[model samples]
Target: MLTEKQIATETHKQKSKFVTVIHPEKLIATKTTEENNDNTFLISWLFLIGSLMFLLDGFIELSEGLSIHVLLHITASGVFTIASALFIPKK
Candidate 1:
């Protein structure tokens, strides 16, 4: 029963009720290029160190035949060593 003009005006009124939305720009901590590179290098080194530890454990297992104690010792020492190195203060 509504005319075309009436429908158009009603739609316009509903759309105009919403205000324009503005989104804030993302805030990210910017690191220096050297620092960024250092982070990536440190990550790669960690991967390398982890793989080395796994390989070392494999070797220890082979030599020890079938001993869980030696395996546990090696794993614990590797973890502790890495943790200490990471926690140490840098000059």
Candidate 2:
């Protein structure tokens, strides 16, 4: 009768024969493509804030002056929407 500890050790040894354990560093080091896209969140947040500011500024301008700033804000909001969409991960 094998003890539980002994059985677990034997099972681990047998499983290790079929499994490969690669270190995280080694896996990252062997990547075929190096991506430099580290600022996705930063850019997204910046665009989001910029869109809000532009909208606000447009509203204030609407009270004071021309409709041009509002149009520009609408365009900027669209651009930021698309820019953030690009960074979203696909399932």
Candidate 3:
């Protein structure tokens, strides 16, 4: 049966224990915009190459006519495609 005032004081004490006192003006990004964009594109290109390899493997399995290997390759290719798509550049 704590009073509202008692509860608020306790809550304030707990919150203050975790409060960080950093100046907002001191925060900065380490990488330039162009550098970040280039890194993203490079990672996406590597993933795209892997996905392409899986796609080719799937096509080869298709020639064997409907098997688990084909299904697995297709599933892997689709997953890799989605992953790679996330890092692709907008421009």
Candidate lDDT values, in order: 0.69, 0.67, 0.83
Sort the predicted structures by lDDT, highest score first: 3, 1, 2
Residue range 1-91, candidate 2, lDDT tens digits = 9999999999999888775679999977763432433355566667767766766666676677667756787677667666666755432
Per-residue alpha-carbon lDDT of candidate 3 for residues 30-82, written as tens digits (9 for 90 to 100)? 67889988898888889888887888888888898998878888888878878
TM-score per model over all chains: 0.38, 0.38, 0.57
* Candidate 2 Cα errors over 4 Å, as ranges: 1-38, 66-91
Q: Which one wins by lDDT: 1 or 2?
A: 1
Worst 10 residues of 3 by lDDT: 22-31
Q: Let me know the TM-score candidate 1 reaches against the reference structure.
A: 0.38
Sequence-dependent TM-score of model 2: 0.38
True lDDT of residue 71, candidate 3 = 89
Residue 17 error, candidate 3, Å: 6.9
Looking at model 3, the pairs that clash are none
Ranking by TM-score: 3, 1, 2
Q: What is the number of backbone collisions in each predicted candidate, taken in the order shown?
A: 0, 0, 0
Which stretches of model 3 miss by more than 4 angstroms?
1-29
